[model samples]
Target: MTHIYNDPRGFKEDMIEGFVRAHRDRVRRVPNASAVMSSRAPVKGKVALIIGGGSGHYPAFCGLVGEGLADAAVIGDIFTSPSAEQVYRCTKAVEGGAGVVYSFGNYSGDVMHFGLAEMRCESEGIDVRTVLVTDDVASAPPEQREDRRGIAGDLYVFKVAGASAHRGDPLDEVERLARKANDHTRTVGVAFGGCTLPGKSEPLFRVDPGRMEFGLGIHGEPGVSTSELLPAPELARLLVGKLLEEAPPDADGTVALMLNGLGSTKYEELFVLYRYVSELVERAGLRIHHPLVGEYVTSLDMAGCSLTFLWLDEELRELHDAPARTPAMIWEVKR
Candidate 1:
């Protein structure tokens, strides 16, 4: 797309080098591998969580690998799954005696590759488990929840897993808690425009100018349907309504609301969306225990946003508030 790139084949390496250069103090390239593990590794007997997927979704796999998110992240090319060898290497590199847990979105290629990596780790005597984040309601019917695709809900999984590890939770318990977070989270997104692949001249999908696609996937996969662009409040209401319908908050429940910027969406716009979402959620008789607003997860340069809600309990609240220092996520210890 009139962008800078020698060839499509070199895109991954180009991006990786740039990323390492930019985050040298916090992230380091995994030795003899195509992944980047956090510099703050070997977390003192804590369970290590490894996550990976195709590239182009910056801040999704690698950007989140820091003090409070993933311990290791393996990346493949744009919209492609990392090889089993890469996954195995990352898992081995980050594994502590407590073991390694792989958390990824539910995609056929990811499942196969990561599954193979898991088996390879088991053969090598590394205790490994996996939790797939499948919270996209637009992918399947309510009765077929397992078939749902994973979207922004992965942020919640990383938060729980990292907090568990930070608290010295054993491998098994970390896996359990991560699974719990995955089960209680849901995400739905919309796109005002599709994204362009590196070196490509045009976007993957086209939305009529001034229109938006509701329930859109990060990769420009078809959304539920198209509609005219509505005002920020109305749009928030419609999107949040879908999430509530799928996973309604408890009468007195507390939750963490994540307002994710797809890619090019401005912070001011996201805050506007959050303002309305918080109001609607509170009006529904539910408490928003914490609110995470920013570009925690993103597609390429797509212009849109996604909403993720995590129904929280006491334990989750503590975990959510725990101190975490990372390139993207930093918190001060609360006395």
Candidate 2:
């Protein structure tokens, strides 16, 4: 299918220009790149949290940049990794004396490029740590869990890491908290229909009428299975069942649930799915601290959703509830 923006190479540049122009006060365009450092820089003693990836994942990499999320987000073309230089510049732009924490989904290209950027920061006397998020259960078996791809769970890590930084946690502690969040989280997604790239007139993948792709990735990748579309309640049961089996919620455990729309899904549909997910969790005798239902992360205009559950202890719960003011997320401070 032909896309409107046939020039994929210019995708990042075009997006950055438009994004900064529309949200000038909230975002500052990093010079000569698709990176944008948050206008509300963390205090000098607070650690900085940086996340970046290709541009198609809207709020995932860029929209999450604000007071409560990432301090800086580097952008790349559609489903492409940002250059090491882009990552380095963003790191330099947002780093405070305390240090910087780099968090992103577990993609080989992202890991290699961001890894190089970390080394660059180290060489320049800037402290930095990396946390790779591998929360997608469909990508790997339990024994090879670390090989799983990172998906919406990255948002949970960002929330935890951002709150840690806000509390003036040391760089090491911040990184530790982010890693802990990653370890405690798991996600699974299903797509009703694939998204068409910006310029493309056709979608990358097509779902048979009334069918859904289960365990699909954000980039229109193949799923574990495709089956007839189920009602919201039944679909929720399937998704929640998979997550619970993988990481069962403790009877008294406080959990943070994210019912994220890939892009094209409507809010009403998400709430419907949330309704069932909430019921299932409560049925399992688990407490959901904050049930987030929206498009916290996305995959272009894909018509699907993902569910992420983060089992939280006292410390993680407090951190997760901490006030954050980002374009995409805002909440009360947890005192």
- Candidate 1 Cα outliers beyond 4 Å, as residue runs: 248-252, 332-335
Residues 1-335, candidate 2: write the lDDT tens digits. 32445366676677787778877777788776678877877457778999988778878888888886789888887888999998988877778888899999999999999999999899999988999998998888877878999999999998899889888889889999999899889999999988887666789899999999889898778578999999998998999898888764442366789899998899999988888999998898778877888887788888999999898887888889888776655677444
In angstroms, give how far residue 290 of model 2 lies from its true place: 1.3
Give lDDT tens digits, candidate 1, residues 1-335. Answer: 32677777888888888888989888999998889989988676888989989887767888878887788889988888999999988887888778988998899889999999999999989899999998887788887878888889988888888888878888888898988888788888898988888778789888898899988887768578999988999998997898888664442377788899988898999998999999999887878866878887777888889898888887776777777666666755353
Query: What clash pairs does model 2 have?
Result: 2-200, 2-201, 3-199, 3-200, 3-201, 4-199, 5-199, 323-333
State each model's C-alpha RMSD to the native. Answer: 1.9, 2.1
Candidate 2, run of 10 with poorest lDDT:
1-10
lDDT of each: 0.84, 0.85
Error at 227, model 1, angstroms: 1.8
